[model samples]
Target: MIPAAPLASGRTADVYALDGDRVLRRYRSGGDVRAEAEVMRHLYAEGYPVPRVHHADGPDLVLERVTGPTLVEALVGGDVGVRSAARLLVDLHARLHALPTVRATDPAIRILHLDLHPENVVLAPAGPVVIDWANAREGPSALDRAMTALILAEVAVDRSLPLSAAAHELLMAYVAEAGPLESVAAAARLRADLGAPDAARLPDAVRLVLAAGAPGDRAGAGNLALPDP
Candidate 1:
């Protein structure tokens, strides 16, 4: 057992270091570890820059140790770093979304990094290596984008980590490059609706989306409340 301190914890998983050369991931036993593992494998096979899976035994998984600072830590430096991180995100999303619709339709398919905030991306020698696929699932890309945008906005509000400009640019670039504006718009709305009155509703909405078979328009329905630009 790696006697490493817990690096991070989420609703479904926990991450720890393994002697500074690898990371150990333990999922909540009852959750969708199989699905997550499949998605990780698919993404890796598709050439997306992801941490290499080293071992898997039931709920525990080990992956290659990616070195360097996380995008969130890099963002704290200033606007330039934030903008660079945003650009990397847009690029990564574009590449992932560009995979053939047929391949993307695999039952195991899911949004890559459904929780794509700055913190989930690590800046590596090769580029940005996305981490934390706990929330990943077969879903619309817009939901991923919206989730990332919302998290960035919240960080700005609570932590004074400014990424508004970068976030706006990233959205615009995504729209211009390959994203469906309507879906993005809908996700923005959904975030607003779930965030108000009951902030806890956001996670529920995300779960609902994943359960509904990755439909494209679900994020737009219901009352949507976009954060201030």
Candidate 2:
């Protein structure tokens, strides 16, 4: 089937309206739609809030159309509180990590959404719904949590006060919920090779965020050997 006009576009994919119940997340070249579909299906099976996959043919992924503002949009629009953002994301991350993985690249691991951030979360009527599972895979869950911390750190480094505040709070809470980051010491190399879009910044961001952790944080900046960011 053909998708309608583009609804939104990102660095690697463009979303198109398929119908009232579904939207087509079509990727750019070199995308593995089948693999992405598999991850979504796996998460959905475990009662995650990922969009239900209806079709995955070639570069197009037909997913249940979740209607609501993304967390980023809501935050920018002054619709969501900073503390609430942190708590909700942490809650969601905990839920996601508790689910059994379908593609574990390492032992004693759960599904890892290597690209979870506010922009990927939609404030759905049922609750927060996470989208974008293209980078979903397996390894150490701490690395998964670390990846998110690094992302928010990249934003926390920005000069904008509002952006920095939100990013910093989220970064702090995420790191705290993730427990001691010492667990990711050995996985540094693995995350570096994970092909996350902004991983190049992860090394520096990880160090900065960890060091910037407040006194009350559950995880301290004890000793971290970060990979090249």
Candidate 3:
């Protein structure tokens, strides 16, 4: 199909609206588009809230067009609150991790959405649906949650995405849901090496969360505060 004007663009792909109900995601980088499509298909089949994959061709993927504000947009527009954002963040992972791992080319561990956050979450009419699967991998659930926390921190301390409160609240909620952290430092280091846009800010954010201790503990939820830049 002849490409029309793109509706949105991101670091890894460009989004083009197609026949109203669908959209085309054309990659801007050399990453494995097919792998991304595969991952989406996997999660979709398992009843997870991922955009339905219509087709995938090399760097181009056709996906169901979901309508609704992203959690970040909702927060910015005052359509949602910090407390709601926190719940959404925690709930997104809980729902994702709850699904049984059907397959994996690697260790066959849990499917990890290494980039889950408000920006990628769409509060669709049915509920919240996750988008962007380029950074997904099959790995430990904690590592996945850790990656999300790092991104949240990056938003607050690094990129300053304007939804810093959402990020801050999510981190504490994550701590509450994730229980105790084992190797958050290792997870932060791992994500930093991947060169995400906010990788530079991860160390500081991770340190702050660790310093706050686990949520519900003395320095966590009981004394919860947004660790900002």
Worst 10 residues of 3 by lDDT: 216-225
Error of 2 at 193 (Å): 3.9
Regarding TM-score, does 1 or 3 come out ahead? 3
Residue 211 in candidate 1, Cα distance off native in Å = 29
RMSD in Å for candidate 3, one decimal? 5.5
lDDT of 1 by residue, 1-229 (tens): 7655677776667788886778888876544366666667777887887788877777887888888787757756653453466577777776766654324556334455656766677888888888876656556765666566544443333323365455444434433343333343455455565344335344444333333233454555444454443
lDDT for each residue of candidate 3 in 72-168, tens digit (9 for 90 to 100) = 8897888987667777777778778777765754443688888888889999999989999888877777777767766777766644466666567
- The local distance difference test score of model 2 is 0.74
Q: List the RMSD of every prediction in angstroms.
A: 7.1, 3.9, 5.5
Q: What is the lDDT of candidate 1?
A: 0.59
How many backbone collisions does model 1 have? Answer: 7
Q: Is candidate 2 or 3 superior in lDDT? A: 3
Misplaced by over 4 Å in model 3 are 104-108, 159-161, 214-229
Which TM-score value belongs to model 1? 0.67
Q: Which ten residues in a row have the lowest lDDT in candidate 2?
A: 214-223
